[model samples]
Target: MDITDNLAAVRRKKLSRRAFNRTLLSAGVGMVATPLIGTRQVVAQETEQGTIFTWGGYDVGELYTSYEAANGALPNFAIFGGTEEALTKMRGGFTPDIAHPCNAGLKRWVDTGMFQPIDTSRLSNWGDVIPELVAMDGNDAGDGQPWLAPFDWGGTSITYRTDLFELEEEESWDMLWDKRYAGQLGSLASGGDAWWCGAIKAGVPFGEIATDEAFEKISAAMREQRPLIRVYTDDTTTLEQALSSGEMAAAMTWNSSAVALASEGIPVRFARPKEGALTWVCGLMVHKDAPNLDKAYEIIDSLLSVEAGKFMINDYGYGHSNAKSFDQFDAQTLVGLGLSKDPGDILSAGHFMIPQSQEWETRMNETFEMIKAGF
Candidate 1:
């Protein structure tokens, strides 16, 4: 089935008691039988390996190896393109101990019963994580339990070639829709973030706008700019190639990818325009029926530990929600990651990716598809 079809199926299943009861029963059995249940009968703290699903560059395998060396086991990792794709996989029965999805996408995952409640009490560093990251209904399991551990976040900003576009002369969201750059612009290919850029360019609020009219407006805007699109891609490597070769003179991009392309001497520059950005925060959440829950928390603890956050900040140029990571990394490192000693500036400017109602999401996807088809 197509994504729309799959989404419909998920909605139907969520409303079906047979499916819900089966899931509940499975979770109950898994909780009781697995080593994760802290009951006296189950070995809650046993050493074991777990599987993790995440986006590329988020999991530096060496970190897992180090955790394994210290803790007697490691997590097997898998990478995904986006949250929608990850959720689609879960619905199709692709199981992993943990899946990394952004905060905005959590409601769908939680509503579908894809994840288990987190044992926040067992996590050594749970309290150290920024409270704002977990400040959501899905942070806890459907059963009033904590479901996920928060991770690094970043923004969807305008990444233009400074050498290609004069910065002092050109600094606006207009760079993306500029007719002058016809056949030389790029954007995210995935539906959610792609439409997010379209909405922002069309003057729609990133977090609000719950109507079909808003979707149509954004879709029309994207359609108008469609001819100018050089490529619609999810791969940063492809975007870097486009930027370097001038296949794309300018584009909407994630901050880390822009920084990486820029640092390569490709003359790229990132900007948060007056219209703001489509930002997102990703975190690790375990499946309720995961085969290995203890190992999952171990993976979470290791990844969210101050050391891992520092590594992510320094190596990847992505911002971490861990407030203490700044103390662990130097000023130069923090600057590279776009983190300030004072984080309030970051919070003030950043937009959280929010989960709109599924009905709106469906309409948004349909509108985007129509625009892309016409293109």
Candidate 2:
């Protein structure tokens, strides 16, 4: 059958909490919604289709298409420039059914109490996630409810024009603040991740350097590099465009974007750096008052599927949290995706973004503003 015909067949399947398993695996509607190994009770009802909010390059179109093929309806998607932008929209009452944010930022999200616990029992493929990802830190509600379900996980490494900058001698975070490349550097405008970059460059401990004094030093370091930065861009496409034209020689960037650009023959390379790149892990979270809990979980389940994980690694150049997904990849594919066949090696040089209190976030933002204004 054609794509349209398969979708229609999916719609006829009737999504039910209990009947999820009896379905066949034809045309993407093959998800098994059985109860946990020793659990009881039907999972949950499949609510209405949802609108998912996430950063660009996080969730790809294949996920949505696959969901539609399986469930007969597609979730609406809204992409944002950064976690802050998504939060700002949420603050402005632009509620989406699902939101994607990094683990470091989940506390602020949980503080709002606008999220609900993930029903792992309903997630048929939760077992597929790597133990490291599931065990990754997250902000829990005061009552002890976990707020996020992880999807794609990666790092924020320096992406430099290899053809322009030699990686040997300058294979460190100092390249971000090099006077020789002043006014040509690039970084995200968001203070959350950018401040960590600045802090690391100033030789501050990733978790211990949140004081005003340390922030001031970080601010000064950023200010000193102002002459080298041409753009404070958070948009990957725009950054890539600028890099393609040589408008930027180097920048603190998401590792996946750097890999994707290199794939397109942009001659860019991601670095581990002397201080180690600031790593970030993000995941899907259901809204506290989400209108479509069951449907949202279905989407989450689809995301956690090995098939979906394979597509994510191959197409998006991201390292998936699904442990089994890596087994499908060969040596070359692993190298191309900037991953190691061994999980430990992949995480050796990476560091998780430090979760901070709200007060600290405010201080970092204030300091970043001063730095941006040439203070």
Candidate 3:
């Protein structure tokens, strides 16, 4: 079944509250909905209390154990589906104390002048975070203070059903476009990943993605590949379910999907393509006009804590910013999950998505949507 049908099935199942929460959080579905235009009142009221605008699952109690223990209550939470949506809401005057965005979006977020620099000294666990992560592109300002605190890092590549697809030679991104698996293939819905993967197949370097020729090449490649896709979705749960049920031979996905599927004894593999995986790091940033600055710092530090790091790695199958989190798993286990002992190595091995201008991002997203609509 396609993702739409799978979701219909889930709704019909009438899952228990716990199971339903997991589905919503795991899918990163936004908890609150509002149109892009017009203004709305901020949800939380107390100045001493803070609200976190982040992806769904990050708001769970386990992640904020430290903060909750100290404050005697969990902070207010609002969720966003993606960085662009969160940025749009912020620009529309939604003032959440903290917002989560990936490294690729750091420059764009900073350019908006909506966030403030985090005081690293305030975080007790700051010394233990991977230095390279803290120093990633767009993390630092010219004055030397950092704005984003790196939280979760992972790779983007093909996650395929091992039983249905065989790699005769080196695993390559070309597998997604192989005519033999045309009707069985799937890919991410967003241009952020799909477009870059197309650029890789077109032999366009990450650095040249902004050029007119590179844009044409990437667009053509995607248009050619679109008809092959059985479904396009950001919901990894749907992709995992389809792959497990033998409905899809392959799909472009992150490390977490492969990990989830393999744990369930599904015949799955996260491919290390010849062109390399796309790597990214996402983190938290404080709002420039944050009402509860102290509480925001607590939330950031708690997320970077060793306890939270453990949850991030084991539960979510992502690499944590804290170096000590690697100690939780053995070398072989880490290898099986396609993670290195040092996340810096993973970042170096793949093309870390660079920041693009707002204009470029807008155009690319619109073009990708047109292609997906069979234009």
The numbered model that scores best in TM-score is 3
Candidate numbers sorted by TM-score from highest down: 3, 2, 1
Clashing pairs in 2: 114-288, 115-288, 182-228, 183-227, 183-228, 183-229, 184-228
Each candidate: what lDDT? 0.73, 0.73, 0.85
Q: Over 4 Å off in model 1, which ranges?
A: 1-48, 71-73, 137-145, 167-170, 330-336
lDDT of 3 by residue, 1-375 (tens): 323344565779955666667667856644344332223344324444678999767778888889989898888888887668888899999898999888767888999999889888899888899998888876786466799988889888999988899777888998999888888899989787888788888999888889999889988999999989999997777888889988899999888888889889988999999898888888889999998889999999889998998887887778999999899889887888888787777888888788787888888899999999998
Better of 1 and 2 by TM-score: 2
lDDT (C-alpha) at residue 248 in model 2? 81
lDDT of 1 by residue, 1-375 (tens): 212333465767753656557667967998778764455433333224687888887666644644686666556667889766777888898788888877667777777777777878877777778876677545765454566677877778788887776554546677888888898889888777888777777887765666667766887888888888888888888887888888888887787777788678777777767777666777888888888777787888878777777766666667776788778777775666566665556655766566766677667777777777774
Better of 2 and 3 by lDDT: 3
Global fold similarity of model 3 (TM-score) = 0.86
Please list the Cα RMSD from the true structure of every candidate, rounded to 1 decimal place. Answer: 14.0, 14.5, 13.2
| Model 1 lDDT, residue 266, Cα | 79
Which 10 consecutive residues of model 3 have the lowest summed lDDT?
A: 35-44
